[model samples]
Target: MADSLNCSSGNCSSAQEAFGLSEGHFALVKAAVLGCIFLLASFSNLFLLHALWKRRNRRTRTQLFLLHLCLADLVVAFFQVLPQFSIEITHRFKGSDLVCRAVKYLQVVGMFASTYMIVAMTIDRYHAVCKPMVSFFRGSFRRYVAISAAWLISLAFSAPQMFIFSLQEVEKKVFDCWATFIEPWGGRIYITWITLSVFVLPALILMYCQIKICAGIY
Candidate 1:
């Protein structure tokens, strides 16, 4: 994500000229910043995944949910961030239509799936606290189902990105891949839904849970 932001940081060529930085210098700066981000995120997620893997036998369903969360984040870091990092280093986004679509698809799916995983975690907590007698969440099978559904749902929501983006030439024989949604209102509606699902729905759910807990305590 940081890599994407940096590469798409307001006209790269213009920025270099204004700042008097060479392509190599810009690439180096990008490498340093993106390298740090990827290193920290990848290592941390890997460590967590490893720890969880070792304790797999002892893990509860919640632990599995957390495990899925980490996996989702790792997916985003790898697909969304890593590809952009490579682009910055190469100074272009030269790839086939299939690769461009796949990269963008995974990036969007991973992002939304990560948030959905968190929402799943929150729902589990809500159930545990508010409806203690419901023993429906103990099975590992349910965790598998939930995680699968999260990815599927996210993929459904993010499918538009695949068609909305195509590789466009940015420099001589060099290309940059970005979303060029043909339907402006369609894009706006999709973005609005994404915002609601990722931000509003989760906030409302968490808030409701908090209110329930407060009421119970009172």
Candidate 2:
């Protein structure tokens, strides 16, 4: 039992190592905490999705973007985060190359999709308030196009991770499934670009739009 509770290798293990707790105690605690989080996230996302779908009749621009955001978060929670919890508990990845790549791809796609949805929301609000000449991007067709474009863009950005990561066995010990950079600094550069594009750029745009909105209101 004590052996079972000991830190296996990755995140939970690291925490236990840091806290100086016995493997059994901390492992159960980690498992319980993670299990609760998974359940709460799953239920909350499902409810949000259900609520969004129920309000489909209203289908405003904001609603559409929010629906997509909920879907993206649901995908991340189920396809990426849940599977990751299992890996964190075990402290190793033993899935096939296809499985690994698919999971990693979905993870990246979900992240980018969520980020782009926020950007879409920001742009929509900005255009509706500031550039009324451009119109609020109404109609079902335009909304579908916007959604399709967001997914396509997310897919294009996430595709590189699919190709870069493969199941590489290290020293016949642990199987670590992570992105393999071809160049020395390739991974760092990729992450930095992703961070900037998905987070920083959208944040800046949101801030600019907020300022414009304030100015317009005042």
Please, what is the whole-model Cα lDDT of each candidate in the order they appear?
Answer: 0.75, 0.73
RMSD of each: 3.9, 5.2
Candidate 2 achieves a global lDDT of 0.73
Please list all clashing residue pairs in model 1, or write none if there are none: none
lDDT of 2 by residue, 1-218 (tens): 21221223443466777889877667566666767777887788789778888988876677778778888887777776676677657757769889888987897898888888777676666667777765544544555676787888899998887887766664476566666665767766776888897889879988998999878778
| Cα-based lDDT at residue 39, candidate 2 | 84
Backbone clashes, candidate 2: 3
lDDT, model 2, position 19: 86
Which candidate's lDDT is highest? 1
Q: List the residue pairs that clash in candidate 2.
A: 5-23, 5-24, 6-23
User: On a 0 to 100 scale, what is the lDDT of residue 13 in model 2?
Assistant: 60
Report the Cα lDDT for residue 143, model 1: 58
